[model samples]
Target: MLWGALPYMVIVFCITATIWRYVTNPFSWTSKSSEMLEKRLLRWGSLLFHIGIFAVICGHIAGLLVPIEFYHWIGLSDEAYHMGAVFGGLPAGIIAFAGLVILLVRRYTARRVRATSSVGDWLALAMLIIVIVTGILATSANAVNHSGFDYRTTINPWLRGLLVFQPDPALMQTVPMNFKVHILLTFVLYCVFPFTRLVHMLSMPLGYLRRSYVLYRRRDGAIYPNQNQEQQKERAM
Candidate 1:
């Protein structure tokens, strides 16, 4: 009951809080990048972390949302599907872990960033690393240790049940300890996500794709925007 209910409760609270935050303090909905203070590590770390996270999210969606019956229908045996999960999940998890290491290092070493960092920042970073580490361990157990554990039969259905409002905690009871840690931490991350820089995710500027680009042209010694507006007001006066 705790496992099933906790995730939904966290998600609901996060959604409600996120909406309130965005509505009341829209300008604060940002990642608040500190790249200007230190670009060297930031560039590499940000690229790897974001890309790895994208891959991880994709993998999670496929594993959790797609039904196991679908794989059987497609003629993929359980062993084959497990192989695919290990092969795909391991690399992505490792890349994300590496990037997270660099980011954590940068967070502490960069004087300006460190000075400005809050308790929430450190807490978020620590939890993120823990989640990634546990996830890699779970995947590695099957890939390296050859335990042949299949999460499709366990975690996947539990998640689907949660989606339909028929959460069954029993579904997650048999999940490995590492995997349980991963799931708990992930939802905890979701709960904290709105109050942190992750809130920027919701404000993705997708409109930029359809919006017209700025066409810069040589304006000689023409006034800037504010100056141009001031001149217009003067003429009106």
Candidate 2:
């Protein structure tokens, strides 16, 4: 019964929070990069995390959104599909988790970044890591089993039903614990997102193609030479 209500509840909660966030603080919809404080680790970590996450999202779209019949229709067997997911999911999860670790380390080690960090940042990162770890646990467990947990049979229908405004809690109730935990955490993330920097995901700059380039210039009256002695050697003599 709990599972039955959770889907609709989370959907409503996310929708309401999103609406409120957009209305109250539209200007705060940013990821708030700390590139100026530290760029080297940030560059690699951000790249890996984004790439892995994009792949993971794509994988979920293929698995959850696409029905089993579609695969069979395209001459793909269930076993083949499961094998593909096992191979694809493991590396993606690892990459994403590794990147998150790097980002977290950078946040703690860099003085400027650590000074600006908030509780929201830590909470968001912790939840994200939990979601990824649970996901990988589910995938790796299924890979070792004699038969993979065919989520398309259970979780997929339930999710599709939800998309059409129908809630089928029974479908998710039987899902493996790891996968269920992953799903529940995901919904929880929806609730927390509006209050955190995670909202930046929704506001990604899709208009970049049409936007003009930003120009930045260093302010004058600021000393550029690292050593004042170099510029004032004559005065020293």
Which candidate achieves the best lDDT against the true structure?
A: 2
Runs in model 1 with CA error above 4 Å? 210-237
Q: Tens-digit lDDT track for model 2 on 134-212?
A: 8998888878875547899998888898888787887876688878888888888877877888887776567998999
Write down the lDDT that model 2 would get.
Answer: 0.84
Tens digit per residue, CA lDDT, model 1, 1-237: 467667878988999999999999988877888988999998888888888888999999989999999989999988878777778878888888788899899999999999989877887788888888888887886567766567888889988998998888898777778788778888888888878887776677889999996644346433543456665677577
| lDDT, candidates in the order shown | 0.83, 0.84
How many clashes does each candidate structure show, in the order listed? 0, 0
lDDT of 2 at 93: 90
Global Cα RMSD, each model: 5.1, 6.1
